[model samples]
Target chain A: MTVEKTKTRLNIGADPREFQKRPSWTNEDILALLDEEDGTLDPRIYTDEDLYRLEQERVFGRAWILLGHETHVPKPGDFLTTYMGEDPVILVRQKDKSLRVFLNQCPHRGMRICRTDGGNAKSFTCSYHGWAYDLGGNLINVPYESEAFCSDFNKSEWGPTHARVETYKGLVFANWDKNAPTLLEYLSDATYYMDHMLDRTPAGTEVIGGMQKWVIPCNWKFAAEQFCSDMYHAGTVSHLSGIEAGLPEGMELSDTKIPTVGYQFRAKWGGHGTGFYVGEPGMMLAIMGPKVTEYWTDSEAANRAEKHLGSAERARQLMVQHMTVFPTCSFLPGINTVRTWQPRGPHETEIWAFTVVDADAPEEVKEEYRRQTLRTFSAGGVFEQDDGENWVEIQSVLRGHQARKRRFNIQMGKGRSGVGNKDFPGSIGYVYNEEAARGLYRQWIRMMTEPSWETLGP
Target chain B: MIDEKMRAATRQGDISLEALSLQHEVEQFYYREALLLDRHEFNDWFDLLDEDIRYFMPIRTNRTRREQKKLEYTKDNEFAHFDDDLTMMRGRQRKLMSDVGWSENPASRTRHIVGNVLIEEELSASELSVVSSFIVYRNRLERQVDIFAGERLDVLRRAENELGFKIAKRTIHIDQSTILSNNLSLFF
Candidate 1:
């Protein structure tokens, strides 16, 4: 399908290492890393420095990355500094109350214009030089601009690069590729699953607290892929200790059962995916405790969500749902912990996590969400502790030469997936399946290789 | 427990023998508590905490200088590293002792170096507000090692039990905005 590539003023700065020559991997080499039909993946995808650099340009450069929630920048001049790939960008609220994302770097010497995590600011002045930028990222002042240069030196031409900003419900996203599809188009059928957490109430979702930042030594995709499709880990082993420890009073381990009846949704177009138990809140009860479980399933807020979503399955029964919107953004619906797996390097990921509750919910419910998410999913959370252990161990093992040569077995529920489910959208599969994982890699490959929006856009 | 009156009392000089004895007792309590934690004597360490204890660790943030006082650390009712009450702390203790807590399965060797103790307030005859700095060093499976440095604001209650004091409340202020460790599997 032919499509016109939209013009984007976002300037992805020149590669800082452009002077150095490095070993190259062709598109054919990148394509061979994942065997979609075979469901086997090369380990190098998680370790190679060169491949990681390419991903910064091809995958992260084009995809719409989740930066922050709208609640973070409620008033005009409010801004939050975040990363789109390795490149730092500032998500700022304009004077018109619209949002704009621009590179945090100063155009003069490539120093960051804003250093603080987030706060309201009239303009960002670079610490390196006296260059200043308006809320809209327009170059407003430069040190000795008129005196140091000729009359032809234009101040307007030297502003930091700007990214195309959009919001899906209350979540803000920024994209650098001008040719890429809009955020909604990029999200596609995945919005059905996303609305479970996001569009639950008419008042929409609000972040419960400030962002909790932590570092994990692992590939970013490991966290992304698991959130997209790895419910298998939760049921079989990873969270058993957490569940047993978090069991409600008067309840025994024998009373708790893992839910089997569920569906995994793999987006037909985008790489987004989510898996959830259909009728059981057993896992939810264990992880989020009884208060959050009751509020999520049987409370007035949940009833409103059921009416608002128009699907009982999504609002009430889809318990303990884990999801990823391609590349990096991930969240749990019932647990309500939204996060971005900010890729640091080939071997490390910086996680910025926060909890969100329906804005219209009572104070007690909101406080319950904050407390429960802290206990169950934050940096020191019970379930969260196990996840990082597995990832870090795997990453450590991959340091071996033989380990890098072996292929990962991702062939779970391969031929068992089908489209056009009656209740769910997208390609539906069993909850304990890796069909979504394959879909994630397939889209990753497509984004890595496809050069034009004519082929990549919807 | 630390009221304005108690805070004011802490600043006033009181070099009486009673004060010196109480100071030595509090320091000894901390050293023993650190030893119990380092020895993986979790249940013993658990006994050192009051049943109504509030163990908390706020998530630190990098904010502008003007906003630092209000926004540098997460608030009491907000997201934090460890916002555990007695029941939650019990759950964590239970998880650690269990076989399936993979993060600590092989069991990290930890040494909680606690020092710089100062009595911040004398809340009552039975309660005292104490502040101390600690450096917790953990060495996990193979080459994984982490060092966490933080200051703890604690309210210690004098008890009739053998331990002499119990931690009624503890608020840990870790130095880093972004935690360098993978997970806080071990306690501070």
Candidate 2:
């Protein structure tokens, strides 16, 4: 009960803006990136709180977010609790067995109705006053409905406020904006790469286990950008493991790990990027050479596993680790898992990772797939923890007023462009370039400077 | 459930240490290993690992007996985190040594106090098994200090000449479920 009065309220419904801390993004700010010299990115993106609030409204609110995989809710009455850019969202199975997503806040007093992370409940009960709703998220009961309402209370009219829930392949997507493009339309070429992730399996992909969530203190942009292209800081500022993995130690920027071990692609299609050692030059191809198969073996075994799961064509198309969905979803196709990052505040983020497995794959393989997922992406996995320290430090250091002043450049391997394999599904840049981060900033600019979907007309 | 193999080894298996001669060598070896880590002598600490050493922090989980489906630690279990192999261990050590391994930049001056070293007293001649308790306290820059106290079960195997009886594997079982607030940045 004490958490009630002090808990940060989600209802900023009508509060006048009074938090005078930092400057918001302006058109001039985005245009600066167009210049080669003065257009460098300000480190303020990592620290500024006002910029974050604006982003939540401008970018996250507009982007088509990856919610969860379709495999989660199989039959009616099932539901899973997750957050979309910090808004609690409930993914439910309707009576028709179709899946739907809604804002998890109870319509009555704006209280979060469900506390359990996931469950198979017949209806939702608001813990505060026991206002209950059926599995369809329709208000079904109140302790004293007769006494409280004057007989005209229409539960149908008070049904859940709907969110735009859709999916591209097996990956479920939701949008706060009503008129956002179809998940596939928004995905565009990004979907081409997604096919390698989703369609490759025979029975299609399903979220294998419960989501992995960890609280991180960093700007969501910082975390999201880091997921795709913070490769420039690889050996030095970040990986303590990199240093331990025999990186010459110093705090020098150059000492940081470079994405040199992999290639990077900045997709022009959906403003998303995929960075990997999936045959990109300069990578430690020798060590990863034999195990090129997404999971354990070579590409052949990978293709074979794909065929075993579904179709040969699907397996052929999608056999690499190129799955970073726009805005927030990152799928390591090779690892067969998708990570959705929910930004809570300017300094805090919660990451959710879900692995996908073939429905028809052998139980041992499914179990093996589970083990493989554990090996790396899980919170305690080597790379997972390795990246955590850096993200945390990135969040913590932005606290410095002076330290946040200098402009950080994503100019690495910039002019080394024009390297594209037209046959490939997504944009291809030189392996290990920060071009992906540049693409992120570019999309960010579009969202910030663009008009709202409502005024633009349907 | 603890693997039947590890438990049986503790009961009877490749756990003979008479060849390495009881507490003396085992105590000295573990003490030396801890010293190398605390001192940041990573390369040297690496040398102490018997070439074939299997250094692992297999996850620790809380599984209740009455659960319908007898579940053990799996990938889905919330993995607080772990490190495996000399590569990762030394990787952490190297990061700590760096000017901005910030986690330990203001290096925590530590004293690894170890005690109650005991031999399993019943295993094969080639293997030497031992158990010891430890408390390591770390004090670094402007943050709260960290300490981890726990028991270690070790299996040492004698090798050819230059490679003497060395750690075949070392598994750390903490006294408490929660790690002492510090991420285990160093090997125990």
Candidate 3:
């Protein structure tokens, strides 16, 4: 191929030219930073700029990132503009009711084809050059094409790049890597944990409100890793004040006791992970108000969930659960606050969060879930306020050269993980463990170092 | 007192002396509220709200100009930043004052600049519809500074209290769709 052809292919999201612009850090150097067995992590991983760029290309580009729900664009012409890592993409519903995600950039002049967040659009015309694309992201018209361009100039050859789309229950996910594993294969054992919220009822789930977004000056991994493996924060000190203040009338802080019976699941294949307290409702009552707690744990809604999931543990017992589907998608099951930790840079993350509810739920139950999630997990949430503070402080501290040179400890529950839990699947460990964190970093190293899907694919 | 005669006169753009005095009193009430918030007198600030006050700040969205009227802001019963009743506000106050509320433990220094005070309508003999613009500046931990500019639609009611008026309702409309601050840890 000519150099011009190669450049065109690169711009249109063909196999990225990883070998030409390789960073100084080798596979061995990246591997040395993370010691999975000893459970230690070098602080440089959170602060390095080169590593961040590699993550965007390798991890986010290959991973099946959760974009939105099916209900987000239920109609034929509906669309939602969101991000796949730093790359802007438009998720649109076609005339056949199928979903497609394509780079929002116009292939001609590289201007965004859809500037609005989301709406029904039969065709998107680029505001900069008047190049038009159909809902499927096919270039249909170029202004003065017959007059200015050669007769052989084809619109099909200049369409924006498209990503592979898939849905697990109602959640829509998109992937740019054609060679990567299918969504289910990539999710692996994580699906069992994801179903606790997404597939709790036969009616499935629907997003409650418009997305709530805010920027936190912290690494995306901090938010992703905490959701994946750090239930330890909740059981201990991080949320005590917020929980105490949110307790219902007649309930004292002293009256509540932390439940010790819970398990954390680290996905055996993928980096996905979740931790939940079994048969516990006290913490749920504090975080998600009483009405929502009742709806989630004791109401007919709970009964329906148990019947649909075919297990009482998944339906009624897993309270205040947190999970991350690898990279950036994270959510809380009972609270039903789903979010993507969109990485802005090495030191900043934009959080886009939304609540979801069972479609068949009563209006009051749905409303309660909406209200409770806002109070507990949205941008201005009492509990969420504490989390951002911790992440921001840690990121700020990493600004120091001395701070970036130190090796941090990740040895919370190193040897306690094993398989064969009856109610759960994948590698099981105690709720307050860093086993999942090890799994997450382990996967991160593999993605950062491996050049192609031949070695990385499941 | 804001009786029906005065309200009718104000509505007709007559600008009665009572109307002028009431407007001045309303503006002063806002300045006093701003002072309490800036001084970290949260309890005193709470006292200025009615027991049944609805403090709401809805999430905003980016939509096409044609759809702005319908989809620009989240509707009532939808997710919002601060959809608080009295109980919820009290809970927030408790968290703000608590020892372990790390977000506020080393409390942020803030300036609540209130301006553009407008009494939109006299809804009833005791209640008045008011609108005001604000620019809140918060500086924390040496160099972290966040400036929030927003307009508030408020319902102020005459009350037999020290402040002479209670904020019965407030709907905050922030200018940005995506909040730049890490968290809305402090009141707007």
Candidate 4:
């Protein structure tokens, strides 16, 4: 292969020769360096469009992307407008008691049909014109269907195309690919971790409040990478010590534990466990607030946690802080918040957050849920608001020409990986290993090089 | 002549109280409650509320005329405003006193004004249900702040000494739909 730079494309300085030579993007080729004892990540992964578009097609298009929670659309005609892999989507409850996902764009002029965040709509008429469709995405009326066109204009053919919709527990997922894996299968080992939350309740969890949406100025990766045992940033880019005032009465927490959990498990396939930061429940119960502390001690809290969580004396300790579902979502069980970093441009992403509570919980319990969510994840949240600013500033500096020349480090506990250990799930160091980030970018390299997913599976 | 008339006159409402009587008493009771809050005397405020007091502020949501969706986005299970107990109120106050509580540090100055008192009815022998319109002006460093006006439906009962009607409960009805400012830190 001729080795050189491409002028039109941003030559992110990763050995460009590899892209010219490789025909198929296989897991093995990228996994090749992933297991290398002394390998480094190229910083180009932050900005390369070729790799970005591929990820949109392969990862997001193929993976079970979380559209919106079921609570957002409880009744028939309830609709929420969201995006499924860059395709504008409308998640609505159908007359058949099933959920439907459809392209929000009009079939005629391709204008977006629904512009609002959420509402109960019997039918959506295109804002540009009057092309109307129902919850089922069947074209019922067009302003000029009869007069402007011949009977040859088939309204049936022009109806919005619906995407594949499925659910794991209560989470709704949309797949652009018709032949994608089942939602449960796509979840894999991630299910094992999720069962602790979903199985805890006999009726399953219900989203109490609707979703909270916020935007951050960073690549989607920055938000995704935050779940990968990145506690090194705890004391720097965000607040680890600043918010720790005193707790209520009968509370005690020295600055000993980490705020988020730290665990990384390899999927039966290639998916990994969300590594949580390690904070103790004693601290959370005390500092989070009084109403919250009472809910944690309540019997339902334990009865639910026990069904899915294995019998461990300390399982309900609230120690597993950041229980992330890697690649995109981060579900913090302690605070009961669901947030997604949906990538907008290469440098910007929307941080959509939702607060969850038990559907059957008492009013006091729900009130506590609201308080904890607001204190931790609201617009003026103690933790999130601070980190978002840093993400914005970091991307600003990285995208600058002067800052682009340097390569940053991902090598945490070097030479500590590759050799397997008992406590950790992956073939890396301990549970709080940097191997997840290593694994993520390695997968990135594989996708960038390979053609379509002709080389997937074990 | 006014003092002589007050000693013998009945209240504007019917069915006069058989208990203590003093014109200056009710005004002082309100003034004292405002003083306790303005002074950040949360302990005194806690003492003022009856043990069985019901405190609530339902969330307000914009609903179409046909549908009556409960202001609760959280399925009508939780309170949108303060629904607190004695212990919880004390805990909140403790947090405010803490050194690290940034929102309360150099605290936003506040002044409570009460007027247009309407004695609705004598709820009980000792308890009086009343409504008063009030305006509280609040300002911090960065932003100009003001709470225009609201009516407070209050149940006032004679304190242990029976000197006057002490506020047993207060429910404020704010006219503004939106809480444009951040947190609801102080009492209305």
For model 3, how does the per-residue alpha-carbon lDDT over B57-80 read when each residue is reduced to its tens digit? 998888899888888898986778
Q: Can you tell me which runs of candidate 3 are displaced by over 4 Å?
A: A1-23, B4-9
Sort by DockQ, top down from the best? 3, 1, 2, 4
DockQ of each: 0.75, 0.14, 0.77, 0.07
TM-scores of chain B, in order: 0.92, 0.68, 0.95, 0.73
- Candidate 4 residues lying further than 4 Å off, grouped into runs, are A1-39, A48-55, A235-237, A241-246, A249-262, A268-271, A277-279, A290-300, A313-318, A413-431, B1-188
Looking at model 2, residue B155 earns an lDDT score of: 82
lDDT of 4 by residue, A1-458 (tens): 22122113454566556657655434444344333255454344565555567678767766567776787788999877788657788999987779999888998889988876667878888878888998899998988667788867888898887788997778788877776556776666567556544555666677755555546657787777765445455433244422352244454324335444344543444444444433345445533565665555447666555544654332354333454454676666656777666877667777666767666767777767775565555433544544664566667777764354344556665556453533333444444556666655554455445555456433
| Per-residue accuracy of model 4 over B26-138 as CA lDDT, tens digit each | 55676777777777776676677776554444333333333335321323343234445454455555545555444455566777788776656666556667778878777
True contacts kept of each: 0.69, 0.13, 0.69, 0.03
Name the weakest run of 10 consecutive residues (lDDT summed) in model 2 chain A: A281-290
Q: Which CAPRI tier for candidate 3?
A: medium
What is candidate 1's lDDT per residue for B78-179, written digit by digit as tens? 789888889888888878887888888989999999999998788876789899999999999998889999999999997876778899999999999988
lDDT of 1 at A138: 92
For candidate 2, chain B by itself scores a TM value of 0.68
Whichever of 2 and 4 has more TM-score, that candidate is: 2
State candidate 3's DockQ.
0.77
Sort the predicted structures by TM-score, highest score first: 3, 1, 2, 4
Q: What is the C-alpha lDDT profile of model 1 across A325-396, one tens digit per residue?
A: 998999999899999999999999999998888999889888888888988897799889999999999999
